[model samples]
Target chain A: MEEKCTNVCQNHLTAVGDALYVIGGKWKLRIIIALKDGHNRFNDLQRTITGISAKVLSTELKDLEMNGFVKRTVHTGTPVIVEYELTGYSDTLHEVLSALGNWGTMHREKIRAER
Target chain B: MEEKCTNVCQNHLTAVGDALYVIGGKWKLRIIIALKDGHNRFNDLQRTITGISAKVLSTELKDLEMNGFVKRTVHTGTPVIVEYELTGYSDTLHEVLSALGNWGTMHREKIRAER
Candidate 1:
């Protein structure tokens, strides 16, 4: 019989690869998190998520939009406004965020203890 | 009272940033997974992880080694062989891997369904 671990390992690699393909790089996750945290408009997002340039944020947002993680909406009022919103990613993003946070906490503790 | 969501959101951004800091970028996670998947030797790793050049792999391995994720062991025998082994990161990595894998699986399905 084929070992169960081989299957699990392959799954892990494939999943990680897919996750990385969509959400890797510096700004993508930050942009998602910032938008989730209520900073929606371009200027607000630019201000809240520090150190990101307008050009890079624009590029990353377009990429995320293409990947179905984000959708940009425009409002016509006295002044036209554009806001970035999340696609229905709660089921996927919530767990991934929590687990990643836990991993980060443990990693910091481990490194601190080692040092 | 201060908003609960603000704290949670901050935690998420911090956690994701930290985790990404430790395990982000293209090659680091791939290298770690390959090593864990039983490809231990230098040549084996180079071959198992396709499309990675010897120089880039060497650089990534050394980076991993410095970050306390990988340890290189030298066996002195007829032929001196070196193998890479993991550091004690099971508590952190196991959950992260599983979560990332699940996210990947869902993400693929979602994108496919959307199309």
Candidate 2:
């Protein structure tokens, strides 16, 4: 029983570690939320996310793309246009995002109450 | 409609930011999970977590305590004993942790498929 419990604990740790590796950084979740909100174009994302610089945004987008959460499309036109959209896999994070948002609000309230 | 949408987006950004701030580091979630799994002693946690140093574990526990996710109790006896446990507030993250674990498993499968 103890060994089984330890195995379960280790699995949970690995799962959490994996989740963090994909969505762990400061900007990943923010960027995912932005894309989910229909801010698809590079400039639109930059403007909507507030203080994110273009370079950091670019790097994060690439990371998201490589991880399969985001799809990037380039349109050739008078001026080349680039857009990013969340893949179906990214939609799997909706529940996680909602949970995080709720906890965050509660945490903020707790902090405010203590202060 | 646009103004309301923008307001909602900003609120989400803020909430997510707050969540990350509270549970954001490399070790915070791991520590929380460890404590949740009945590993309370400092040395036990250090062993269960596998690459965490005593210094990092100590810092993260302090942060978790400050954020209300963890409680620390000191027992004074022939030898002083310190133990950490998850607070009720930490239970609020059950859904979030489950979601993250599920997603992480899926992500690992996706990566394996690609490789």
Candidate 3:
């Protein structure tokens, strides 16, 4: 019985691990939320997401793009404008984000009550 | 206006940051899931959560306890057994874990489709 429980738990552990790997970094979800309102250029994202350094934002954006959560576009214009936007695939995370946000609010209240 | 947007985005960013801070480590969620199945002794948790080192498990358990998500109880017996259990507060995280697990399954499928 214990062995059977371990096997089932192992599958759950892997799923959680995969979720964290894709969206686990300090900046990924923040960047995603920043882009939620609308598409953003590099500087705009940096400003919108408070406290994110330019280099880290650049790297995180690239990772998001690679993971299919974000789309990066380059416009052929006099200034060659570049923009980043969330893909449809990224919309799949809305519930997860909301869940995290709701839990965070509750956790904050719990901490305050303890103090 | 962009200023208004920044203010709202800042609030969201803070919430996400708080959530990540509490449950962001590689092992924290795994440990939480392991405890979800049942109250477990230290050695049992060590086995249930694959790949976690004894030292890391010890530290994470302390953090979870401090954060009010876990309760530690010691049995006063000849052998002095210690057990860890998830608190009701930790049950609040069930939705978040489920969302993560669901998203993770989708993400793995997405990756496989891409390759």
Model 1 misplacement above 4 A: A1-7, A113-115, B1-5, B112-115
Candidate 2 CAPRI assessment class = medium
DockQ of 2: 0.56
* Candidate 1 vs candidate 3, TM-score winner: 3
Candidate 1, pairs of clashing residues: none
Candidates 1 and 2, the one with greater lDDT: 2
lDDT score, candidate 2, position A13: 88
lDDT of 2 by residue, A1-115 (tens): 1222277778888988999988997889999988878888887888888789999999999999997789999999968988899999888888779888888888788888889
Candidate 3 docking class: medium
- The DockQ leader among the candidates is 3
Candidates in descending lDDT order: 2, 3, 1
DockQ of each: 0.49, 0.56, 0.61
- Restricted to chain B, the TM-score per model reads 0.79, 0.90, 0.90
